[model samples]
Target: MTQIAYFEPSYTAHNARDWEIRGSYKYPSLLGDLHTMAKITLLMPTLPPETDPHRIMLETNYDVRFVALDTLDDAGDANIESLVEDYATAIANLEPDIVSTLNGRMIGHNFALARAAKAVGKDFVYRIAGNDIATQIAVREAAGRPVTGTAYLATLIAQERYAAEVARSVIVMGGTERERAAGRVADPSKIHICRRGVDQSHFTPAANASKSCNRILFVGRNSAEKGIDLIEGAADMLAKTRPEIEFTVAGDFDPRTEGNRHYLGFHGYADLPTLYQDHDALLLPARSEGFPQVVMEAMSCGLPAILSKSLFEHDFGAGDGVTLIDRDVRSIVDAISSWHDDDSLFAKVRSEAIGQAKEHFDATENGEHYHTILLGQGK
Candidate 1:
C-alpha cells in the first residue's frame, strides 16, 4: 500500500476521534477512507502542556497512526528552523511516499512542512483549506490595509506564491479556488477542485416530524468576519418585531441568553445533526470562505441556509438550497422573515436543500475523489 503522511496542525484530542462523536469529521472521514487504500499517517502538533497527547492517538482509528511533533507549537510556528529540521527528520523516519498538508499558507508550519517534504524527496501536495491567497488579499484590502504597505502581508503573499509554485499538486475546494490557483500555479492541470463532503446517513433529515420555521441556527466562529454581529443585530431586532423567531448560536463562545437569542455553547459532531433538524434554517454571513461544511450538514438535515451573497455566488448559484443575501442586519432579518411567513417556500427550500446534499455532497463519493487526487491517479 502507498504510504501517505497527512499534516494538519490544528488536529487535536478534541477533534480527532475513531468513532463518530464531537466536532467536525471532514478530516477524519477523508483520512478514514484514504486509510483503506493507503497507509495513512496523521501528523499533528503536540497538544498544550495540560492536554494529554496520548488521548489523540487513543481516540484516533487504529488503522491510521497519529504522530505528534513535540518541537512544533499549536500553530506550528515555534522555532522555525528547529521545527523544519524536526519535521524533515520525522518525514525521513516515516518514509511516506506523499506528504500532504492543509492550508498551505505563508505560516511557518506549512512553509516548513513543504520544505521538509522536499528535503526528504517526498512529493508535497498543497491543499488550500480555505479561501485562496488572492481572495484573502482582497479581503485584507477591502478592510483598508494595502498589501504593499504591510510588511507581514507582503511576506505572506510571497511565501504562499512560492509554496503554490513548488507543490507537486494543489487541491482546492471549489471553482473560485481553481481559478485563483491558475494565476499562481505554473501548470493549470495540477490544480484540482475537490469539495468537502457530508455523510448523508449521519446528517439526514428528521424522521416523522413536522416542520416549524421558528428556530434559526448559527454554527461557526463568533467573530465579525463570520458575520456573527449581523446575526446578533438581526436576532435583537426580530425579538421585538417577531417574538416567535429565536436564534441559537453554537461554537467555541461564551453563552448568552436574552429574549429569543440563546447561545448553546460548543457542540460535538454527533449533536449537530439534531441541532440542524430542530432548527428551521442555518445562517452564515461570513466575509469569506472556501466551502463551508456547516451549509452542507444543515442542508443534509433538510434545513435551508441563508448565506453571504458575495462570498458564495461562485460556488452556490441560484436554486442550490441556499438563500443568498447581503451581509447586513436588514438582509438577514428579511430573509428569515420571508421563510417564516411563507410555508410553501420553506418546504420547497427544505426539499431542495436535501436534494442538493444527497446529490453532490455525499462523503463516500468525495472521499474517493480525494483518494484519487492524493495518489496522483487523476494525472
Candidate 2:
C-alpha cells in the first residue's frame, strides 16, 4: 500500500476558537474516500499544541490518522526552517511514499513540505490553489489588505517558485491556476488540471423546493477579491429596477455593507446546503479563484450560477451551466434581469447545473483520480 502524507496549514474555521469542535464539511467526501483507498496521514500545525493528537474523534475518519506539530507563536506561524525540520522528522516517522500539499503558496505549510521532500530525496506533489501572484496583487489593490511584509511576500514567492521547480508533479485546481503555474515551472508537462469537487449527497436539492423565483445569493469570504463591493453595487442597482429580486450574501461577509441586501453571517459547512437551497441562484463575481468549492456545492443543490467571466473562463468552459458577466454593477444587474425574464433559459441552466455537478463534481471520483496520480499510475 502506498503511504501519502497530506499537509495543510490550518483546519480551524473562521469564527471558531477551538480546533477540535471546528467543522470539516469539506473533507469527509474527498479525504474520507482517500482513506479507504490508501493510507493517508493528515499532518497539521497547531498553536498551544493539542495533548492527544493521536486520539480519534467521532467526526474524523477512523482510517486516517491525525498528527499535529507545534508552531512558534500563538498565531500558529512556523518558520520555514523549523517547518522543514519538523516535516523531515514526520517523514522519518511516517515513511510516506509521496508527500502532498494542498496549498502550494509561499507561506503555506506545503512549501516547507516541498523543501523537506527535496532535502530527503522523496517525491513531492504540490496542489496549487487560485491565489497566484496576480490575484494577490489584485486583492492588495482592491481590499487594502496587507500582503504579509514586502520582504515576506518576496520570500513566499521565491518559495513557491522553488516548489514548482522541484516538485515531481503538480495538481492545479483549475485551468487558470495551471496556466499560472506553467508560467513559473520549468516543465509544464508536470502540471495537471483538477477542479474542486463536492459531496452531492450532503448538498442535495431541497425536498420541498419552494425557493423564490428571483432570489440571488453570494457566499464567500468578505474579501475584496471576492467582489463584495461589486455585490453591494449590484444589489443597489437591482433594488431600484427589479425591486422584487432579493439579494443575500451568506457566509463570512462584512456586516457594515452599504446595501439593502440581507447579509447572513458566516455559515459553516453543516449549514451551507440548506442555505444554498434557500436561494434561486449564486452570484459570485470573484477576481480570482481555483474552482470555488461553494459553486460546486451550490450546483449540487441544483442552483444555477452567475459568475465573473474570468472565473467562468478559467474553470467552467463555455456551454456549462453558468451565466458569465463582467464583475461590474451593470453587468450583474443585467444578468439578474435576464435570468428572471427568460423561463426556458432559467430552467435549462438549473437542470444543467445539477447535471454538471453529478457528472464532474463527485468527491469520490476526485479522490480516486488523486490516488491514481499519487501512486504514479497516471503519470
Candidate 3:
C-alpha cells in the first residue's frame, strides 16, 4: 500500500469519534472513501500527550493511523525553534510517500511539513478550505472594525503564497476560489476544485409535508460577515409587512434580544435534518464565503435559499434552490414575500434545488472524485 500522510487542523479531541460531535466530519468522510486505495496516516496537531495517537474507530471505515503533535499550536508560545524541530520530527516519523497538508492557521506547520516532505523526496499537496486573510479582512471591513496589526496579516499572506508555490497539487473549494489562488501560484494548472460535500440522504426533507413558505431559517456564524444585522433588519421589516413569516437562527452566535427572530442557539450536526424540515427557506446575506457548508446542507434538505448577490455570484451563480438578492433591506423583504406569494416560482426553485443538491453537493459523488485526485488519476 502506498503510504499517504494527511495533515490538517486537528479537530477537537484529535480523534475520529469526536468529528461528528464537532460537526466537522468533512475530512473523515473524504478520507474514508480513499482508504481502500492507499495506506492513510492522519497527522493532527495540538493534541495532549495522553491522547492515543494510534487509536482507530470502527465508524469511519477509513482505518486512519492518527499521529498527534503538540508543537502545532503557537498560542502565545515563544519557543519557535523548538516547535519547528518537533513538527519536522513528528512528520518525518510517518515516512509518507505523499504529504498532503491543509492550508490553515499556524504558518509554521506549513513550513515544517513542506521542509519534511522535501527532505523525504515526497510530493506535497496543499488543500485550502478558506482563505483566512480574505475572511478576516472582509469581516473586519463589514463590521467597521479596525485592523489590529500588520505582522499577522503579512504572515497569513505569506503562508498562502508559500503553500501554493511549493505544493504539487492545490485543492480549492470552488471556481472563484481557484481564481483567487491562481494569482499566487506559478502554474494555475496545478489548482483543482473539490467542493465541500454533503450527506444528501441524511439532510432530506420530510415526505409529504405541506408548503407554507413562511418559516425562514438562517444558519451560520452570528458575525458581521454572516450578515447578522441584515437578518435582524429583514426580520424587523417582515414582522410588519408579512406578519405570518417567522425567522429562526441556528449556529454559534445568538441574535435574540427583544426581536422578532427566534434563536435556536448552537445545534449539533444531528439536529440539522429536523431543523430543515421545520423551516421553509434559508435566508443568508453573508459578505463572503468559500462555498459555505450550510448552503449545501440546506439544499440537501430540499430547502430553498435567499442569498446576497455577492455570495450568489461567488458560489451559487444562478443556481437552483436559491434566489439572489442585494444587501438592501427592501430586497430581503421582497424576496421573502415572493417565496410566500409566488407559487410558480417557488415550486420551480424547490424542485430544482433538490436536484442540484444531489448532482453537485452529494458526498458520495464528490468523495469518489476526490479519491481519484488523491491517486493522481484525473484532471
lDDT of 3 by residue, 269-337 (tens): 777888887887888887766777888888888788998776456566564778889988789988989
**How far is 329's C-alpha from truth in model 2 (Å)?**
1.3
Better of 1 and 3 by TM-score: 3
Estimate, for each residue in 1-379, the C-alpha lDDT of model 1 and write its tens digit. 9998877554443444422231135456565456668887767674322243433543455365667765555332346678678889989989999988632333555667778888888888888867544445655676886654576666665666666777888888877667767887678899887766888889999985346578899998664467777898999999888899999998867898877888877677778899888888999988767777888889898888999887777677667788899989999999999988888888888888888888888888887888789899885
Q: Rate the local accuracy (lDDT) of all candidates.
A: 0.74, 0.72, 0.71
Higher-ranked by lDDT: 1 or 3: 1
TM-score for predicted model 2 compared with the true structure: 0.85
Candidate 2 residue lDDT tens string, 94-190: 7888888643343346667788898887889887766665567677766666665676578667777888788888887777678778977989988
- Residue range with the least summed lDDT across 10 consecutive positions in model 3: 50-59
* Candidate maximizing lDDT: 1
Residue 122, candidate 1: Cα error in Å is 1.5
Count of clashes in candidate 3:
0
| lDDT, ranked from best to worst | 1, 2, 3
